[model samples]
Target: MQSPLRHGRAALGTTIATGALAALSQAPERASRLFRHRFPTVAVTGMTGVGKTRLADRLSRRASAEGTQDVGSAVMERRTRRDPRMRGYRFRVVPGENAATRLGALDEVFHDEPVDGVLHVVAYGHATPRRTAGTSGAGAATREEQLAAELEDWSITAHRIAGMAVRRDRPTWLVIAVTKADLFADDIDAAVDYYSPGSGSPFADKLDELRALAGGAKLSIDVLPVCAQGGGRKSSMPEKAATELLNRLELRLAQLSGHV
Candidate 1:
């Protein structure tokens, strides 16, 4: 079935990059400066099943109606067709996992490559355990405990990345994308509407706490709600996630140019 909503430009390829450049070209000074360096790289990372692979598949224009399988540690590059100078923009997707491996992967990105941004993809659904027989306790307690654990995991990821950003000589931006928002559409007016304080979702409260943690570490950070998969009951689409990611690339590239 055809989607009713028109996808905003497909996956930041030539046409989209050209359009982005056109917008930046309006300010010739910035455009000229920004194009002087090789394109920046952003890494998509998070816990397993948080939708990192799906996000990468959609961004790479490889998404299908059903879904995409997990591809570990994939590297894809994009360059503006009009100008070779704006070349080598890359997205290196490191498979999502818990704190044990997330930190190691992040450490590599920071030390091994000159990464301009990091996309920390997390899912709201992680808080809700899958239904099964012979459950351990009341559903609410289970959910609450699940959310708390998720928060701890996310905080560890954020703390490690923020620590790297603070100590690294070069500057980097961290864009936190809360994925799987569509699954909870009824509860949230927007992606994060349910994540707000007092919303009773530990995920929301923890997200708020993450910001303070970032500030304390002095890392540039921003968070957005995204449905990488379509916006239906358990639907998956990457249009919004792709658009937001592209926007972040443009913004981060420009910022990095000044410091370069």
Candidate 2:
């Protein structure tokens, strides 16, 4: 018969040996984790209503659609596959205030994180029309003068935005969003008469202005007309623009991942 002390000692010895084997097996994993602690991220900066959130969601969905798997937190991701889902750049949605706040936020996020690229959106108009083309209560005779002021302001701001981007190290692709197409459409009749009276539509006039603004910025700006909300009895006309924006975003991601 074995003594109780001897039996207890043997049991304790077996437990210790098992723990040692477990620790030995996990040593490589710990080393691998240390290696994975270094990964790059993409910093996305845009205005509050410029569809940044929508783009991020679409990007995630598109990444998964490309048949990417095996994304480990502390494990090495083989960016070799150009998989946006698991690649060199991760996304950090930097929040911003109004237009100026947007630039500020971009600076702060880039300074503190790993940023490979930036997605910036610049759009037009606010809640109000700024000016209207009319008789102007007989006081302001020159309606054209009022319109000129509005356009000049837009042009000035547009240039300022572009300059700020240059200072911030602009991204591979800068998307210029043309928001509020529907609002312009509301003025379609008036606009068609004012700009394109012969036969062209109001949107035709809008596109020209958008193109002009984009050219001013010196960015290969892709115009996206989106209506997150809609007017009564009218469906949005720029639905195609939304698709184009999404497609462009995916292509940009692919390019960054080195897939394209």
* Candidate 1 residue 167 C-alpha distance from true site, Å: 1.8
- Candidate 1 residue-wise lDDT, 177-237, digit = tens: 7666656545435545544544556565665565565553445555566655554333444
Error of 1 at 93 (Å): 2.2
* Model 2 stretches astray by more than 4 angstroms: 1-40, 62-89, 98-108, 126-234, 238-241
* Candidate 1, superposed: residue stretches over 4 Å from native: 1-38, 64-88, 98-103, 126-146, 169-171, 189-218, 231-260
Output the lDDT of residue 99, model 1.
40
lDDT of 2 by residue, 114-178 (tens): 24444443223332222223534322224344344434433433444443444443332333334
Q: Report, for every candidate in turn, its global Cα lDDT versus the true structure.
A: 0.55, 0.43
Pick out the ten consecutive residues of candidate 1 with the lowest summed lDDT. Answer: 74-83
209 in model 1: Cα distance from truth in Å? Answer: 6.1
Error of 1 at 16 (Å): 43
Residue 9, candidate 2: alpha-carbon lDDT:
99
